[model samples]
Target: MGVVRAAGAQAAARLTARACRIAGRGATSLPGKVLLRLDPAAIGDLARRLPDGSIVISATNGKTTTAAMTAAILEADGRSAVHNRSGANMAGGIATTLLDARGDIGLLEVDEFWLDGVAAALKPRVTVLGNLFRDQLDRYGELEAIAQRWRVLAQSTVGQLVLNADDPAIAALGRGASSPIYFGVDDSRIGLDAAPHASDATHCGTCGTPFVYERRYLGHLGIYRCDVCATRRPAPSVVAQEVQLDGVSGSRFELVIDRTASIVELPLPGLYNVYNALGAAAAAHALGISMSTIVVGLEAVRPAFGRGESVAIAGRALKILLVKNPAGANEVLRTLSLEGGPLDLLAVLNDQIADGRDVSWIWDADFEGLAPTIGHATCAGTRAAEMALRLKYAGVAPSRITVCEDLPAALGAALDAGMGPLYAMPTYTAMLELRRELVRRGAAGDSFA
Candidate 1:
């Protein structure tokens, strides 16, 4: 049975590679969909080929970034990992990633809904659980429902659960386990004292009463202690301290892992990513990566495409952010607000097959908070005018907003719109479109091959 499965997987990978070549597309999740046509267990088949088992990272946000961090730590420690870095969270994405790797360990970023089935099949050596907030309400339903699903899945996985202790939703999970480790940030300098409007996870997962927070980082992620019955954020087996953000590009922090001390620099940005770095660091330590090797690998890492990724754009630097849902979009806005100066924004909206067919999530995003600070705004994509209208209602001065239905034209107009730095926030498919346009205009690197 195993021999037959290996042969089948080999054939599938070859066929998918051929399709990608012929279609002139960068490696895509569509290949996985192709494999499913042959066998639904195609991802599992691919995973079995990896010798050192795997680690599965899943959440509504930060899966790709977190998985990339773990893979970097592994490679630094001399173990290679097959990963899905293109935001393909389905079974097919998993299949394609595994088939591409020549490594023993598989590091995968999976969708929240796919967790139960994928976890059962891969039987990973470790799993990392980041916080869960309401994202894509139409598709994901509610935060409570998704957390319930994770709890059910955790009950079955035999490996260790590296959970985000600050998230009450995740803190409530993996309770039966005696060996799970938690990783969270403890730097008071970077902590949020009171919960913001975006904050969730206030109630005790154990007691249902509102929990007290010792600190609040973006969106209910921070140190917390329950007063009613003593439920609280677990002290991390690994914790990040003295965090220092180096703009939207990178950060440095001291990681206390299993009692050893090491300073690490991450190639990604945002306070959210600090938690991601800690998760990766803790999980790597559990997997036996030396602190020195982990440090080397993390510093060598680069941002995954469209997630705080910066590229040389026609002699100037442009940062790309994929803003698909509300919670994430709001955080990006908050991050930008800290700049304390005029900012340029390019917001692209598309109601396409890959981007959620519904674009209403834009309203839920706190665009109003982004208005006063937006010195120049250029809206693009097929729904550019729609986005402009939305921004106008959000208090953006109409005079400062420009709508360019043509992507190339919009990007150029946006780049020239404002005086300060440009922030491009596009939806899932719109981001792809913008990338293609950048390629056409000789604005982006041809590293796709």
Candidate 2:
């Protein structure tokens, strides 16, 4: 943990990263792994060098996009950040980001499970806990377990806490915190008629009574209250009102902060993204960023990689929307439902470690809603047959679903079969493979690029 030893570890890690790049491999997390092996406290040591300190953002979904939005806001404010923009959020990724640091501050998107350790190390100026859903049940047990950890983090961290007031599990974390900045959507126009079957947080964390939702938004995120304990969604200082979701193009919402409002034109789709924008705005406000600057930054932000990233392949548009779990997948499907046409899809489902071995969560996702709109669907990845079967069960014609385990071949077939924009919905590893194939074909940039 000494200066000399930390310097030596960083040098070794840098050399390893150079070798990884030479060998045509991603250097995102490997070098950090090497650095940590040499110096276990390297993250803290390097993070301490940043004069402006760090900000940590974590959630089951939208952490990457939220962090990207916050990074854009920082850049608009003429500040530089050492950001893990490559969707790397674990200890290794955080260390690699610190190793390659050249900026005054750190903008880190941490994994939900790793938030505690990284927060302990970075002791960020602001810790943004976006909404958490049931993800990777094999690795991350239950939602309550992560919430308990976050509750501890909220209690122990000295930095300001930015929480989503709509999520009961997340809003409850602010109960003991001194002054948590809460953010949520104030628009009831976009709320679901009723909570979906995939909704995770149905009961109050305090009294174990079922929450009565006045209006349900994405998943369990909505305006809700508990009758037994009187626990309710916190009033958010940062709220998005009069929201307008513009399908795959993006969305617009009134960004309201402390009663003052500004129209924000966010170039990202879905109600889920609205939540992301609210969290980013709240976090930026907590850092003393002006409302005007926040609006400009939100407007300027782009899609974070596979999350709504569009690619041009052989003149046909292919939009990559990542679907990892039930809640996240439901949002993506809901967004797709907004587009006015029969959709062409390249749906890839992988049971990789990163994607979660239990692929049963696909059953919980409301694929039935989007089935009628499918023009032609190409299923690929380790679970291609299973994915195709799910689509068939969801009312997609069996003849319309083509099974191809190979990603490149499936992409080609999907392109050939579709006349319009093709939406590629892939799990974590499948998305990496799909992007790699696109990069190889000169259709897209590298993941880190």
Candidate 3:
């Protein structure tokens, strides 16, 4: 590390400590508006100081869960893996996390928008490219824009490029690489019968021709063939197939790595997570770990916060999913096909800064189909009335919807509405409020329980 950069990192560590003390919360990513008080070279220089090189994981969705899964795999194999588990995905977050770790295998979860900046600062040893979907249309112009950035940085990266074969946006990222390692689901039973409302990849990235789908796993992902010229889902080196999602029962699938195969069952539900497991397993294999350790680590790891996140409440488990954008929220709602009868729902909508200034994307979500199964719903947040109105339009009876401005009251009403399990879907900031409410209501004991 350069002298100036080393000094900057030390300064950042000290400053991070000061900020934590001032805020009374643990050190976290600086607010975007907060003055960035460090040398830009400090992050890159510190990465060199670590024994194990950096691993950068980027995606529109699944980045957090994939980061957790990869870190758990590394930790289970007895490697010290450092990560930003607090959902901090910017330059300061990466810098502060690296500063705190001093030296460890850094599994950095970075935002798609900040990939270039973070990559220029921290030249990662391995980069995992998960599928890209249309999300936060205002912040990110389009899925193609993020892919373009990845395309540029992939040339400069010194380590393995772990790409997703199912996502053509991610698949095209490996165009110039020397057979970059790929991982995806090869199962037929676990995908959509045809394209659903949320599928994005219709036109080929390489050519402008419309891509034909042989099968679709989730949204915009599946084995596809380009009709015009040459563009399709890349064949992954490590693939998962014969996948079976048993809803509440969990998912069991087979993994093929280095030509060896094994059956593994993840306690987490949904098909998207099957892809998450594949991404983590592929990264683990690239890290040179055995299949056994990968299997155990994956099986042992639990879900991430608000991404198919579950909590035990009132003697029943409540699944809390963060429905921030259209594609992600649609996928979560689509997973409802696995649910049986009517389900209790708690939806919180807010225009908080963290939760995007615009909440209009709720209309794009497939809430109409999901509304029928919703037995009772408590709508809360700054936009609680808006959400209640939305549910009403989606065929939900006005009497079935409860609008409570306060989170705790809304949560209580939602919980009391049904003896069946509850599903809390909220925007980003609203999820935090629900978590706080969960703690305050003694739903979870003290201390973020």
Instruction: Score residue 194 of candidate 3 by CA lDDT.
Output: 58
Residues 213-274, model 3: lDDT tens digits: 88887778888889788777777889887887777546888888977999988877778788
lDDT for 124 (candidate 3): 85
Q: How well is each residue in 284-396 modelled by candidate 1, as lDDT tens digits?
A: 87788788887887787778777887766755577898887776787777677766547888899888856667777777777777788888889988788889999999999
lDDT of 2 at 252: 90
Q: Backbone collision count in every prediction?
A: 1, 0, 0
TM-score of each: 0.92, 0.98, 0.93
lDDT digits (tens) for residues 38-154 of candidate 2: 999989888988889899999899999999999999999999999999988999999998997799889999999999988998889999989889998998998889988888888
Please give the CA lDDT of all the candidate structures: 0.79, 0.92, 0.80
Candidate 1 worst ten-residue window by lDDT? 192-201
RMSD (CA, Å), each prediction: 2.4, 1.0, 2.4
Candidate that beats the other on TM-score, 2 or 3, i.e. the better one:
2
Candidate 2: 10-residue stretch with minimal lDDT: 149-158
Ranking by TM-score: 2, 3, 1
Q: Say what the RMSD of model 2 is.
A: 1.0
Best by lDDT: 2
Number of clashing pairs, model 2? 0
Local error of candidate 3 at residue 96 (angstroms): 0.6
